[model samples]
Target: MESTGIQRLFYILWAIIKLNLYILVFTLAGGIVLGMGPAFQSANDVLLTSGMDYQNITFGKMAERFKANFKRSNGIFWIFAALLGIVAYNLFLASQIKGLLWFILSFVLFFAILLLLVVYLYAVQYETTYDISIGNLLKLAFISVFLNFGTFLKVLFGVISILVVTWFFKGLLLFATFSLFLVWSGYATKNIRQLVEGKLG
Candidate 1:
């Protein structure tokens, strides 16, 4: 029996609260240096692993996976950080030039690319679950987003929902909002694994 949308949402929430919290602990602890890259990868791994029908995950296993994820995708994290720095500098320059339109467009483009990069990271994690190479995984991330646009949007919505919820209940950070978002987004992408894998393979 297929789950209703509400049921799936609750399932996603519980998965984060349960299976993915260990990784969140690491993320919150090392967030400044790690930049949520490990957390996102670990949460994606948890959801993808579960989606693939694996069972009986433990906190220790999640932590090990978190380390592996950080190793595999840290480069992407650095690239994201660099791009953010560049965009910030450009925005500052635009402000100095009094180019209001340029500033607005740059800001919009930053977010647009950031959102796409978020989806790409999700795809990267899914690929990493099967031991796909970092190079190939990067290629698949780009393709998967367009190939599975609807699923991408679902994941995006799940992410935005987490932000909204977190804004209202700031205490949710204690409960690990970023972890929840990753797991929720991962759950949203579960159905598309085969679709992506087929094309990737």
Candidate 2:
């Protein structure tokens, strides 16, 4: 049992390393700025579809997925970028102000960012899983966050845990961080996705 558990850990680590390499290579292939979206979508696709079945994860498959998702992934990326920019500007404005209004605005904007974060995470996963319009995808992801608030919290916790660990062991940022987060996001959202599917059916 102990040796089996160790082997499982090794396999998980190896998979994450390979995923990290794939994301890095593809992101650079698009010159980082252009590559970020498609690369992320491709990685998310593998995580959702393959789960722990890392044997089937190949660079060619990732490339194919990245090419297929390029346009739609970029659309999602730019939209979220715009929204995040707006919120960031608001945050900057809040920083310049003083008094109760500033406090309230900051508080509201904090949750707004969180809402956007949850929606963005779900949006990326749903894009790969469903063939829905981006407009409807955003709406569904937004609604799902509230409806599946527990899942949101679980994902949030996983993210925080990873971030905290990465803070102490910064080497993870080099490779494992994003891939680990993707793994957690895939696991955290699985049940909520099933529930949504059941309701739709």
Clash pairs, model 1 backbone? none
lDDT of 1 by residue, 28-133 (tens): 7566478367656665666556652224445666677777767655677666667667766765666565467877876776666556656565655665566666
Candidate 2: which stretches are off by over 4 Å?
none
Candidates' lDDT values, in order?
Answer: 0.64, 0.86
lDDT of 2: 0.86
List, residue by residue over 1-201, the lDDT tens digit for candidate 2.
999999999888888988978888999998998898899889989877777667877888899999999988999988998998899889888978999989899989877887787788888878878898999999888888888678889988898899899999988877798788788877888888888889877
Tell me the lDDT of model 1 at 119: 53
Best by lDDT: 2
After TM-score superposition, the amount by which residue 101's alpha carbon in candidate 1 deviates from its true location, in angstroms, is: 4.1
